[model samples]
Target chain A: MLFRIIKRTDLTGTQAVMFRTAAVFLALLTSSVFIIILGNNPFEVYASMLEGSFGSVYGIKETIIKTIPLVITSLGIAVAFKMKFWNIGAEGQIFMGAFAASYFALNHADIPRPALLVIMAAAGFLVGGLWALIPAIFKAQFGTNETLFTLMMNYIALKWVTYLQYGPWKDPGANGFPKIANFHDNAILPKVFGVHIGWIIAIVLIVIMYVFIHHTKRGFEISVIGESENTARYAGMNVKKIIITSILISGGICGLTGMIQASAVNNTLAVEVTGGVGYMAIITTWLAQLSAPVILLVSFLFAVLVQGGAYIQTAFQIPQSVASIIQGMILFFVLGSEFFIQYKLILNKSILKKEAKGGI
Target chain B: MDFALLFAYAVHAGTPLLFATLGEMVTEKSGNLNLGVEGMMLMGAVMGFQVGIATSNPLLAVVGAAAAGALGGLIFAFLTVTLRANQVVSGLALTIFGTGFAGFFGQKLTGKIVPGPITTFFGEAKVPLLSDIPFVGKILFAQNLFVYFGYVAAIALGVYLFHTRKGLNLRAVGENPAAADASGINISLYKYTHILLGGALCGLGGAYLSLVYVPTWKENITAGRGWIAVALVIFTTWSPYRAIIGSYLFGCLDIIGFRIQDLKIKVSPYIIDMLPYIVTIVVLVFISMRKSKENAPPKGLGNPYFREDR
Candidate 1:
């Protein structure tokens, strides 16, 4: 496991920074609770998050590779999320990529590298985008709840992939289970300089996206739509178009991560295709304030937390679910902390206690 | 498969969704969309099993699940209402918290059956002579007490939402909190009360699963029923009666497909399992076709209401 970096966002002022600090402190306290539950020191569990992610060469490399997909997928969601679109089904979109890669690997096992890679990547992106389009179109046009819509999209995507892996798309030669075919040597991503090439692509995409978000008209329009649909509409922005396009791109990248996992890392698909990266990406992007560059750091931090979770489990015999718990706590603190960053708390003890006593 | 058998299982499958959707409808009517229904249901499943095991009473155990579910909602309310946090984030947090909380706590509670009500309640639900009726009576009327309550809740909630004065205020709050506030409605209290009450109902739905439907406590027992209920809120246009229809449709769709699998039909179980979610997305497409201002969510569904948004 890797000790990944979590992006530290600038809160813009010193005195106002107390909320973010308190959030981290609360997260620390929450992790300590797990430490107590695991029969270990709370400080140790946190140190373990750092130590496990960056403690060894292999761990660091793993963290780097894991962050690649996270960065890419999170960036995808970040594009929409920054505009407050809340595309929570990136995991399912990632599955689309994995499913596509698996399909390509099975169908064209003898294809050449460039041709296969291009087709597989495009297919993954398109499928992811299409998967996202279903919900986005509905959300943009049907008044359906996007959160629920995207969530349902996730299950559908998982089951769709499951159907294939278990049925006609199921690996014919392998025993029962939802296993996809192996990506052949040509289809598999070639590691350059001993690091996964997919990571390189992710890095490139980050720079490009950073430019796109800051320098482009579409990005500005996204912010407008997010701020208010009425305003965006008044400004002549095609709000639905933006929602659809953004979600589709987001889904496409999620698909790219799936393809990377299927071809570069796992070389096959499983239920863990997205590996909870979809939700993790949400937290990462949120941490980075939806800034493209910040995603890199935030992704790394989460990678460590996830990878270290296993170590803590082994060391203390704690259920690996502890990692998820810590994750939840972090998100809780991060989200709660933002309240402080945005709004200062007033200690009107008399009013609060009075309200409390009045049975409100 | 015999129509009677298919019908029976459909009723069974729909029970949890029935309970959850009704709960969400009530909450939404009161102007709060409690996205924590999934969390509430999950806690309900675990708590119901644990409590039922200790007390050896199915009804009492169900009450425990309801209470636990209410607690889950209460936490969400504390955050979103009193604490005035983001509703969407708070709801999502509740789900994450509940998921992890259940996973950690459920390690022991899972796999153990409660002492009572495995088959007794399901077995005892048949009417004296009504059981002899053809497809209509068997499919519609006969079931456990929970199923009957689901139907009653649907009708009763429908009336309470549309007929009553309080229901009008609730609708007023959901549509525009500012308007409701201007009208002197106590916004936070109604939101908290309905959200918690909705949670209790969701918990009961979850309890129905362990105590009556599945007759066992299974990990992930709610199994996206919460998600289904979340969608039902949209599908029903936030209406209690429509929610009932939507939930039952999903429930029936869920069972009919699965029954084919149990009968060892040639279709892929994976594909069959995908039916409900896939269909929901497809329906979402149809719904999205009209997703303009006329039929959209209340303007303030997800935004946290602040007395100071001005």
Candidate 2:
């Protein structure tokens, strides 16, 4: 072999940052080749993306609105991932949460706005948390594969939502088109400043999550469990309880995101309500390494990509799938970069000896 | 419903899944839990569809799809095997990438005239004497070449995994990479080879969808079959023969939905669509509940190997 990889003891903070930046730069550079193949300038494409997401006040608002769900979902996902629980069912949780909120809104249309919002929030959070807990409980009790379990739940939830839109919950006034009924005025989250209150909630949650993960004993226990179950057990940590609670929090938060998104953004439950954010949040949380502030920033960037990707669809005739491709590349490069951070490539032993002997 | 007809329909619907599940089974046997089969299959679907349309050759399309899927596997290998990234995350990234790649190309290919020759090529091939046999003939012999390919692949894999020396080594690698390494097996070599081969199979599965199953280019044409294949691997308890059975069963469940809808049943189509997923969860729960040691997953699964640490 020309080169051998040697595992490093650790990477410094600055070195880690450099590796991430390099990965991002390389991912963009690689994606540029695809742009050129399509007869487009990568720089122009990127500039338009930036402009589309941040150019006008409307663009900014849309970006912020997009960021709200992403930040909340990713932050919620971060909780489960912190314990290495692998809760990939955030999509389902979000849907269930939205469904619960919608159910509340539909039946309680006559209720006061403020009270209805509270009930919807509670309903959404509880439903989402319960949905998430199913997999967590199974994993805790039976040691079942949660990743597959959670993933299966997502399709089930999606199908359930689709059924609702087409069947019992279909809006009677949509003239036979399969559309879920719009939420009552009381169900909608009121806008604060410009965007809905989801942004404020997300910000507050971020701070709470940061404090919970870093400064709390429970967070410390989660880190230990993530490192090793045996070690956590030896330390007298109730690993099962922690795992269940963490996933509940993760799922619950994702569900709350659904409620906010449904009430504030879409104003109706649809099969596409989650908009792939659940899957996107999985990557974002992983990319952020479960850091709350980093998650917020990463999600913001993701929002820009999504908003801008849609923008470029009409502005430049580029398919929105281009954004997915770019996002995948970024994630791939970043994932690959972790290898470089943990292990450095070096010349193979024979080559190293030969080079050293030949050197003056 | 005619039992034999439903069985035949199940076989036809199950071919793609059988390929994917077998592919994933092989990959998992190398201790790498790849969850990107969906993406790889989609990539294969688009590429094979394009090639089939261009050349009008089913054989060429299968080859093309396999190659496309292998390309996906190659990326996954570099990330998980060489770079030692998280297998799950890398697999997810591969799916996202593959899906995007397929969708982009698929969008361009749609509404364009390339003359689909593979459609004619995939016409049913009823074995002359075999077709005359009883119900078994209709259920097994009367099918497209792809269906036979799936059967042969499954049986071949079953034999290979249980009967061959190399197969034993591959299993050993998955079960205990460190032990395999100590016993002079090149763990990385087996991991990469099997992962890539598995990827190719997944790609073929995807190709089967575009070139054989649906016979058209459309966005997300594979639907959730890739994920279903992943679940089927578990349902089969990692056995190729079991995978064949599990795939057909799931396939029947899927087709039954449409069959019921055609019969004017009052059931919502979406509810019927949920059967496979719900069944998967139920199977997963049951399998775990059994807690049988022999049915357990590979011990070294999902963990990166660091030789120096050991």
Candidate 3:
């Protein structure tokens, strides 16, 4: 018997949802094998994972804290991906954003709190946008591979931050071991409830992004260009300008994420400011298929996994890296499941009959 | 300047990269751009170290490393080739999987060094007569077995890729899979074969670090060498021979960062360390700027081929 995969004419929304759900289920099912091998009950492990993320107010807050960066960065990535531009430099972009914001806050410590925050945000937005612009311009003009370019940019940005923390920006008063200087009271972001205002910004941005992508003329241009650059040109859209603008916005939002991480959360510039959220955002954003609402949900799920993963480290003696393994398995399953969503496997009836006759 | 010493160090540093770059090059030539080289290398490093520690056999370590690396590659091929998924996403997932998987197991080997016999097994095997030549001999002929293996592998693969019938077919598969398929080539089989082999080579490179070069287990020991290897494939314009030279040049650049730091220069060493990646971007731009067909990446690179798809 032989089977061949045939492409489907169209995949409905329901089927996509079903496939995605199945992928998640299958991922968990496969993950159970690892859990069992580790001598932990799969059910108890999963229960603990949930409890670790949402068991207490602090756990919930931590999950939200993680989600803020993941959501904001993924949103920024969505804009670029929507335009078919692979902006993988969100890590670098986030660092630049954090660096710029910290620089502003450090130099303008005398400024009023509100004005200082605004300036820091602007600095972050502009710097992050500029960092992203380098590759976008190169990509638009020379057709350079942005994926590798962005990847390289990440290490450069990381090294730059490392240089700062260890060299000029090191807090001298702390003495030895190296550390970035903390923001002054006025420079720090104020909290509304228990958590900082980063999540508030993220929520507001989500609404704006939804409106921007669905209702705005520029958003229409982005979708058109993403679908086909030639088609966009034929429609009289300024392709280069659109590409530049989209990535700038994408990068600007990523910068905002960095700014929040620095001013609100870390309260200082450090190499760990981005905290691998930039890379994680890539997976979440891609997994969400660039949908704003879906990104929020996916980001929340990822944040839970991260927060819970950390919990498992202390709670169950599981290594923190296990989270990455679980996430990777989930991504692999979903990525593979996409094939089934797009195509159908068909058994060859004629081949089966021929096989049966030959056997007889 | 001690040119011979630098050359020897450069050869030592670049061998692992050469293994990885050659593997990535072969995989890329098969039209699947697998970006999980870093992950594969890390897994190879950890797995190879663990096995070497257990068996006290360098040969077994080498095989173990290759097998672990091939497993990483197999995961990639299964997702991208068999399932017709997005190559970039799948590659990234494979990377995440490999890095974490390696890291999770690698904690046990913290601060552990390779077994003594394993090191001696991979130790320098100075060529019989070639070692007698004054300066050039030490730089070229005097090296560990893995270094020699790199040379043999590079030359052999270089010749095979350009001169052999199967190599031509593989090139054809990369350049134009649909056309190759029409001409009776098994596109999927070629892709899976090369990608798996490429991954295994990357694993071997990782193993080299643990077993020969550093010979100690350190977290993220590959530390962007795998990435540099990826860039080297592009920098060398996808020729295995050029990969050898490219890896050495990059290896020299990498070693120079530490060498200069030892000299106590005022400049931050990290800035100097940024040379390879920055140069990679510049080389990529330069390569793109030339806009020649010969210098171009394989036409079908990063695209999944379905026989029915027009």
Candidate 4:
């Protein structure tokens, strides 16, 4: 018998929608099971999570606040992912970016706030881009594996930041905690209305990146590179240049994310300032399938889950680990659904034997 | 402060890394890099700690940890092997799962410390006349079981890969799976079994952390030793003996750093701490830049093998 690959478009339009709906619903169902396993009433826990995240006016604002950094970092990751460059060190890059930005903010306190902030942003972008560039350079020049390189770089960056936090950048008066002095008013990011300046930057970035990836010629080349580097090369697109350029851009945006998270939102840099958002951003980006605007939708829901998790913990005494578990579960189903999209489960030899034996 | 004491500490620290690197070496030789070793190590560390805590039997705890780590590897092999999932994603997911699971489980076992396995934690097992030797005996012969095992594994695995038939076949699978498949070797079986074995060894490495090195169970006792294991796999170019040398070097650097942290070394602790990762990165870059490096990764490394593709 000739083996045939299953066609993805074999299902009807409505069935396709139903499949997606059921998949997402299944994820929610599994998430509820986790809540139940943790010894909490699923409905009450979920309801309280919803209430805590969005029931009050301030809750929604906080959720929005959390979204800014995540959206920014994820959009950067999406750009790199689109080019098939796996930069898992974005967390460390963000740390480096914050460190670089904070250093400038500290040394250049004599400069006007607006100028200082711009310089800080530029420095962060440069540091982040350079951090990413190290791996990109390795990949382009020496064929070094970017994934491991980036991962290693993360530890290096983390240590670099920690060394400072524990030594030079340590809060001089606050005993021995790993934190830095707050930036001056000149370097502090200004808020617009109740929304964080980071959120405003995030919105502007989303629109620009969407246009860059979808409309521009360079963006078009990035998609080609991701599809097949050889094919892109055959088409005379400079694959190395594009990969390096895309990564630089991606890493730079992540730097801006670090700067904003430090200066605008938290007001000071801490070890957890990145808050593992950079890694979760990878999951969010993949869930959105790297669609620039879809990040907003996914991030919105992610923020809610995180917000809800805080509520669940406070209200039900559940471990904060529940949020991480829920994220993992969501990622599980989303990733698993790709199997259905790409391949059909056919009745193989044993299954065929079962069907033959079925008298009914 | 003496060479003998310093040498013993290096051996103790390097032993687990040696095992972990060797385990990763075997897997990479088969052309599948397992980044989940960190997660596996953490799981082993925690599980070993918990079992040792519950039963007070360190040997049984190592066994438990080895089994748990093998199970973790099986999960990785299943995902990348059976499902044809992206190996990197699956390995990463395994790390995530392993990390999260270990953290959750380890919460109960936190701050639980046990006595050091040996009388002085890392004393000796010296040969009769050798123990009296000035510098040589203390450094090489007088040490823990784990240290001896690490050397034995390095030598044994080195012999097996280069000098044995089964080892050749596994290397064959790594070098070119398609050709190996043509030669009627069971690529999938070799990969799955060795991967699990590698996982078990990695589990042992992790268990060593709790059982021997620190003699305490904590949330992240293994820390990032797993990543160092991955780096060592590459650093050694899959050489078993080189793994021992690399791990000891790393261990020595780390030990020395801690020993001299109080001395104003003109370098910040942060920059000093950054040395290992930076060194790893630089070494990898150097490895990549070498034009004549023939024993690079296996030819078919990381690419999924499907008979149908032929």
Model 3 residue B245 CA deviation (Å) reads 1.7
Worst 10 residues of 3 chain A by lDDT: A318-327
The TM-score values for the models, in the order shown, are: 0.88, 0.96, 0.96, 0.89
TM-score of chain A for the candidates in order shown: 0.87, 0.95, 0.96, 0.91
Q: Which portions of model 4 miss their true places by more than 4 Å?
A: A1-52, A176-178, A349-360, B115-133, B261-264, B308-310
lDDT by residue (A1-360, candidate 2, tens digit) is 788778787779998999999999999999888788778999999999999999999999999999999999998898888888888899999999999999988888899999999999999998999999999999999989898899989998999999999999999999999998888888899999989999999999999999998999998988899889999999888899998888878899999988998999999899878998888888888888899999999999889988998898889898877887897898899999998888888878898788889994
Q: What are the per-residue Cα lDDT tens digits for candidate 3 across A1-360?
A: 298778887889998999999998899898778778778887887788899999999999999999999999999999999987878899999999999999988888999999999999999999999999999999999998887788888888888998898888888888787997789988898887899999899999999999999999999999999999999999999999999988989999999899999998899999889998988898899889999999999999989988988988888887776777888889899998888988998999999999899999
TM-score of predicted structure 2, chain A: 0.95
Off by over 4 Å in 2: A349-351, A354-360, B112-117, B261-266
lDDT of 2 by residue, B221-243 (tens): 89978898988888888899888
Clashing pairs for predicted structure model 3, backbone only: none
Evaluate residue B223 in candidate 1 and report its C-alpha lDDT on the 0 to 100 scale: 79
What tens-digit string does per-residue lDDT give for candidate 1 at A288-307?
87888878988987777778
- Per-residue lDDT of model 3, residues B173-235, tens digit only: 999998999999999899999999999999999999988999899888898788788888888
Worst 10 residues of 2 chain A by lDDT: A1-10
TM-score of chain B of each: 0.89, 0.94, 0.96, 0.92
Worst 10 residues of 1 chain B by lDDT: B115-124
